[model samples]
Target chain A: MSSPERSSTPMALIVVAWALVVIPLLYGLVQTIRTASALFTG
Target chain B: MAVPGFLARDRIVAKPGFNRWLIPPAALAVHLCIGQVYATSVYKAALVADFESSLTAIGAIFSIAIVMLGLSAALFGTWVDRNGPRAAMFTSACFWSVGFLVGAAGIATNQLWLLYLGYGVLGGIGLGIGYISPVSTLIKWFPDRPGLATGMAIMGFGGGALIATPLSRQLMSLYDSSYDGTAATTPSGSAVALLFVTFGLVYLVFMMFGAAIVRVPAEGWKPDGFDPSTVKSKALVTTDSVSAANAIKTPQFWLLWIVLFCNVTAGIGILEQASPMVQDFFRDGDASLVTAAAAAGFVGLLSLFNMAGRFVWSSTSDVIGRKGIYMVYLGVGLLLYVALATVGSSAVWLFVLLAALIISFYGGGFATIPAYLRDLFGTYQVGAIHGRLLTAWSAAGVAGPLIVNGVLDTQGTPGELVAGDYRIALFIMVGLLAVGFVANLLVKPVASKWHEPKSQTSPTPERSAAR
Candidate 1:
């Protein structure tokens, strides 16, 4: 069996990369959810 | 134009031990920005009022943009493949940002043609190139789960409007203090101009980030423990690669085209009329039981379902196989359309549920297609093939609205439509879905004649030299 390749990339880089996209995406989803809630609320 | 050495396909090859997960975020950055194409309605009325033009004239800006998106994708698919993702993405950012800058100028100067030339043409080219840039890279990264990788990126496209709609409102309100973000008020033309500039600069930065981070996989790289033989074992999945040129000549490509056209057409029927359809369905003579606010909420809800379905259903395709998942999208979708036409108006909840489910299938069809192409065509030129297939989307963009609007126009005018007005359109969608279902059934493994020779299947000299 081949040994797993060691990743040189830092974990923080991955987190920062994801955070740049995910934070805005979550904000958008939240905003959409708030607007959509009006359907069931009424 | 010669690609700069730094932006060449050879320069961005991944080294050993690179994490594949980083690619999705890069893909999202571009998609989220281009997906802003859908949120044009936020400032649409302002553009119409400012230009002193009819709604159709202002609406043509969006139509032109969508048409250009389809055209540019088909035209540039192969170029993007040869040049690699970074170059395509950087080029897309330039066109997209400059498009907005020019569009802002047009808006400020009150020149409508400039808006058409800038936002509609230039920004749409950005939309097309940016859309397919990362798809093949993502598929390459996640060979074991092509659908999931693609779903993540395309979901960003759906999510783009969710962000842009609210963001545009806030930005417009900031620029035009006289106009609050409400139906009763429209922002000034100048406000929209500033909003375009802001979107242009912001999207340029975001898309550039994607370009920076995206890297093509090294030759012969695969995820640990992923079995290529298992993938080939599945029905209709090909181990061999087909060039985009030959792919077009095949029956499978055209069948998938028919499949996509039908799916998108049916989905757009509900999406284009989502807000009003809810109110019309529940109308008690003159007064709608559904309020305008609730109807807007229904649109919001459908957008949510649309975004979620892109991720959920495409991911599910990894487990169920692409053909089977599409059967659900088309076969089950036909029954859903029938239920919608017959019983949708009987209850508000039923109407919303049916519409939301149908919208979900529409979105699933979009997100799942790249992976489907990968299955039948292999990754060699799958992105280009995928881009060619998007012509169906452009076609459906016109056909879907035409069928719905044509039928509705015959029955009654806007604001006075009832559920019965939509029966013919819904039935037409049902017929279209039946067509797509049969296309899906006809899909088979690509004939061996279409496959590239063993010599061509390996990484080219330029890519190997990059290493």
Candidate 2:
């Protein structure tokens, strides 16, 4: 089977792609700060 | 006359669908996890407090891990290329997970050597393999967009600490009963062990996802609308593909190595002592405004800038070209270091901001160099060349911390709060960046002798027929 061809420059796709990347990163960041705080305090 | 068949087979290129994207993310997942090396200071502080160890003794663990990262990467890089990223990544996952588990056990038992062996030696192996695995594959997939693609994967590496630093701190807190600053009252050894095991399992799964999705494009294939000429015209020294093996022999490779070594060493000096440095700077005769929590937070903020630089500045390289990008990293980086040395105590915010920018450039340097190599050397063996160049990182890892801590120690005032103490170290970093700037300027195009012209040989009938 051939590779699926999506629009190369779709705004929606780019937005979704960025969202996927950003959300996990932000979540990770929150987790990091929370952990550091606990370590320092504990 | 003797062996046309042997020569033809050696010249044959592998078909596409070798799994490129899968490799970089796989590499990233492991690297991001191993990037915990940056956060080892937190553990060191805890160890120092709990075991009542000397700073030099505590530092030995981190030093061992870093030294091992360089040695193992150089040794395993060739293996990854020969065996493929799957085996290499899987091995990395195993060693890294075990290292954490071993470290957890060491903490429970209060056995410092085990922590050193586990995290330093075992985990260091994971770092070496994970780092080099996806580099060449990413370059292959985005031969036309090497900087951006390689940057995407490597940027994750810079960000890895951003995630690990805080997460580890949290995990330590969760497992411990008391929230005391003193390390002696922290959690049981078994609790730390459990956390390591959990982290390992999660990392293994994420890395496997990356490995499963990676595929190499067909040989000579370009993205449907991509133009090779556009890439060549935009880059500093354009060349057709050269395998990673041959790429190292060229002057461009050595110049790139010097650039990375300088950038990494400069950034690491600050990173190694980020928390203490912030505390010392803001400390006054009456009382210090910078709390331990704030210092850790500052480290996290630096991590944010470090991570951001990796993605943003390196991606910018795709547009402005790698050489132009390095000029920014080196030139702007030097200015920021100078500003920090001079204006650091007078205006605290400026020091923080400038320091963040310098750290970002440090992260950006690591993320961007892969693309720089892709620009000068073909993707054929970029991984190997990148692997070889990592010896510079190994060297800087030792040099950076030694310069920072050595200066701090020799001053003979561990508890004597002072801002001017770090001035000499900052100047040292400035000189290093200057050397890097000169090395970057000296980089010339790869000689034509190194290029592999297509006309020198014909394609195999079987491969051509398949296409």
Candidate 3:
């Protein structure tokens, strides 16, 4: 529900939650890319 | 009576300025953590050797957890809605983490039954509750874009595997000094036990987000600019609510069950066979067009698409409408299966492209259904309805593999099979998609007798604020 009040999410909490989701995905992506690159080089 | 301070039922009460956007991340926190269920195979062989038990026995542990997941959701769906997400999440976090702890002890002591009881039965109840705990709240919060909201969380379930697979390997290597990270070299028994304990503690801390931050909207709090009238214009979308008990009696409910069943079963026809299918398609006596390593890469590529499709297609459903999006999944799915059947294996790029798209639709099929349930059944007991419907996934889990494996076994062994050997299974998948299409077409709004009385449908200020 929309409220006239601005987002109450703490600036600190936002970083942590985003990190919770984004960091793992980024790591997985880098690992996958490395594996794919090796496959091509071989 | 709920325990003082422990009873989180009051968390559902929406305060005046509560932010709805925080809810998706909270839901993601739980789903991603519990989704480690898919990565259990990373430890399977090690457990088998350590306990000196069969692979079947170890695999049964996962089966117990999944079956319990469905049963717990069906039994507790209504209780969850009444008690609220915080309570359900709290209990789920307890069961899930305890299941891991018990499982860790089981592995340490080399007791198989303890492992099953801890991770299988108790942990499954955790999975079921955790899975559904966020659904009804997400729907209520994002009534205007239920598809997009639920999709973000459910997509976590799909992505959880991607994260878990690698993380499990890394954790195992970290714990086991002797570890060489390869499929053949397994993690140590002690290492797996430690892994379980670590997962238990990590998940307990993570799942608390939904339990703490989640709140229900106060009565009559619609998002700004959202017209309640627009929901009616979408086919089968309803403003009314249905009791979870009466919902099963309706044809629409069963039809949706069928839609989910057929879609999941058809999708698994590819997923279950992904590794072998690519290799088999290009086999030529001793020289295969696709290498075994290349085929593994293909599987990894499909996993990425599978996760993406859950977020992308389900979010798209918000714009095109729920029923219209399902039509895309089923109708286009049928055509894709046909292409894979008739002319698949013709080229490297062609086969990969079609297979990846098909898998995306597979993931899309799962992510979109919760929003569809919200559309047809109303948010009254959607979590429970969703809980009951997961029985379709469990059923398809068995049936899909049987059809594919059965058909393939008849053709030839895995490596020796050729493109022609799979045409039968591919055609079968096309037929399965067709059945899903018809089920989608048959869905309609629930009748009035089953609907929650009008007064109860809207959140009342007195009752919401009563706590």
Over B155-204, each residue of candidate 1 has an lDDT whose tens digit, in order, gives: 99999999999999989999999989888999999999999999999999
Computed on alpha carbons, the lDDT of every model, listed in order, comes to 0.92, 0.71, 0.83
Q: Which ten residues in a row have the lowest lDDT in candidate 3 chain B?
A: B458-467
Model 1 ranges with Cα > 4 A deviation:
A1-7, B459-467
DockQ per candidate, 2 decimals: 0.55, 0.17, 0.31
Instruction: Sort every candidate by DockQ, greatest first.
Output: 1, 3, 2
Interface RMSD of each: 2.7, 7.4, 3.4
Look at candidate 3 and tell me the lDDT of residue B155.
84
**DockQ of candidate 2 compared with the true complex:** 0.17
Give the CAPRI rating of model 3.
acceptable
Report the C-alpha lDDT of model 2 over A1-42, residue by residue, as the tens digit: 996433223355435434544455676677656644532453
- In candidate 3, residue B462 scores what lDDT? 35
True contacts kept of each: 0.71, 0.11, 0.19
- Best by the DockQ measure: 1
The TM-score measured for candidate 3 stands at 0.93
lDDT per residue for candidate 3 within B1-467, as digits (tens), equals 34345555554566665667777877888888788887787799999999999988998898889889888988777767767788888888999999999999999999999999999999999999999998888988998888898889888887777777778788989999787767768889999999999999988988876577667776677888899999878778888888677889999889989988998898889988887888788788867877766776777777778878999999999999888988989999899999998888898678888998998988998889889989887887788789898888888877898899999899987678999999999999899889989989988788988887777655332332221
TM-score: model 1 vs. ground truth: 0.97
Candidate 1 chain B, run of 10 with poorest lDDT: B458-467
Q: Which sections of candidate 2 miss by over 4 Å?
A: A1-24, A31-42, B1-27, B46-55, B105-111, B179-185, B452-467
lDDT of 2 by residue, B1-467 (tens): 12233223232233442333334454466567667677666555567765668878878887888788888877766566544555666677778878878876776678889888988899888888888877776776676667777777777776666666556556767776563434345544455566666676777676655544444454466766787787767646464766555667788888888899999999998988887887788778745667766676677678777887888888898888889999999989999898888888776567678888998899889989878877787665566667788889999988998899888886657556567888888899999999999999998888888876655212233322221
